[model samples]
Target: MAEVILFYFLMAFILIAALIAVETTDLLSAVICVGAIGFGCALFFLFLRAPDIAITQIVVEVLALVILIRVTISRNATFVTGDREFFASVVSVVILMMIFLMAVQVLNSLPAFGDAVFAEVTDSASKTYISQGMEKTGAANIVSAVILDFRAYDTLGEATVLFTSVIGAAVILRKRPRKLPEEPQI
Candidate 1:
């Protein structure tokens, strides 16, 4: 009961933060609101017994915050949009909501949480991972084994992309020294 309540509270908090992030004109405040959403998502992952995902979420959130700060340091503080832009945003949001509804309908047709979709398959992928992952990879934690061993290349690629983005942001924001004009000697 308490867990359910906590989950709902976190969900509400996430929704509120997201709405604030979307509506706020101040870029820094919006970024901070986005951080709140990230923190809530990490908490949700922790509550779901996915500490690995939670840790990743926290790290990614911090990195994103740093990048956002760097990117916004030289820019104007507030966002300004025209009426046409606002109209386009409204249309985009309506389309997104329709897509979200469709996704929810599709997901509702699938198996419920913790319920196996394939009962006939004696060893589900998760079951196999739990049973074989540790023995194969010599890692005690299943999540670590899966990430470090099974999906190492994918993780490496993600890290590379994140690194590239950080470097790109730094390059874009770097200030070049102005060339001083030389005066003619008498």
Candidate 2:
């Protein structure tokens, strides 16, 4: 069918673009290749009926491209470290692959394997919340009941910590106010 043909065509284009992105000497062209591959991936996800994920990915890809180009062109950005750091990168990648494989294996062994965990959680939460704790919590939203009744302080602490860390990071990373250059002496 035409759909299958289009899928394969996009896949082939993606693979070629990814290869060019990885192996090209020109950074700008590599960025273009990566963007093209990301666009193809978003299109593929849209075709597969994952509109939410596709939209999120496309937005992220655009933001990433903008940020990367901005950083690459910014002041103090001549930051060229030689490719001699390849060995450290190889080791980091190997360790990351091991961690990824372990995570996938753990996920595969979960009770909710091949099933949506949210549906199960919300289903059970509704039953338990309404049956036992409705009078105690007096909340109509069963999902919120389960979360708030059991983990109210935990949730509050998490939000507090997240807000604190974000504010701290912003304060630390914000550029100091620019000073005017001194006038040249006569």
Candidate 3:
């Protein structure tokens, strides 16, 4: 009962933060609101007993907030969008809301928390993974084994892309070397 109340509260907080983030004209405020949304989501994950997800969310949110703060500090501009941008934003929000509603409806139809679910087929992908994951990947934790071994190439590619972007950003932000005045011709 308490968990349900907390969940609803967090959901409301996330929705409010998202709305504020989208509607705000100030870039910094919007970024802060986004961070709030991220924090709320992290809390929600924590409430759901997913400490790993919560930690990941918090780390990602902090990094994103830092990057956004740096960008906003480097430039001074109000985030005033024209009609087209506003229209596009509104359309995207509407689509997102529709998706959220559909997901909620589907979740409502599914089994409740702590409820037993009986399936006709006992042999599923999850069962196969649980039985063979450690053997195949040589990792005790199935999740880690799957991500670090089975999807290693994909993870490496993503890491490489992130590293490249970070390097590019560093190069762009570096102070330019001032040109020395040419010595007077002898």
On TM-score, the leading prediction is: 1
Error of 2 at 44 (Å): 0.6
Q: Which segments of model 1 are wrong by more than 4 Å? A: 82-90, 114-122, 170-186
What would the TM-scores of all predictions be?
0.77, 0.46, 0.67
Could you list the CA RMSD of all candidates, in the order they appear?
5.2, 8.7, 5.6
- Per-residue lDDT over 72-117 for candidate 1, one digit per residue giving the tens place of the 0 to 100 score: 6678645645335788979988999999999999999988665667
Off by over 4 Å in 2: 74-172, 177-186
- After superposition, the stretches of candidate 3 with alpha carbons farther than 4 Å from their true spots are 79-122, 131-140, 167-186
What lDDT does each candidate get? 0.87, 0.77, 0.85
What ranking emerges by lDDT with the best candidate at the front? 1, 3, 2
Clashes of each: 0, 0, 0
TM-score of 3: 0.67
Query: What is the C-alpha lDDT profile of model 3 across 1-186, one tens digit per residue?
Result: 988888889999999999999888888899999999999999999998777789999999999999889878758575656446788979988999999999999999878864535443488666666689988988888767766887789889999999999999888888986689999999
The residue-by-residue lDDT of candidate 2 on 92-119, one tens digit each, is 8899999999999998777653354555
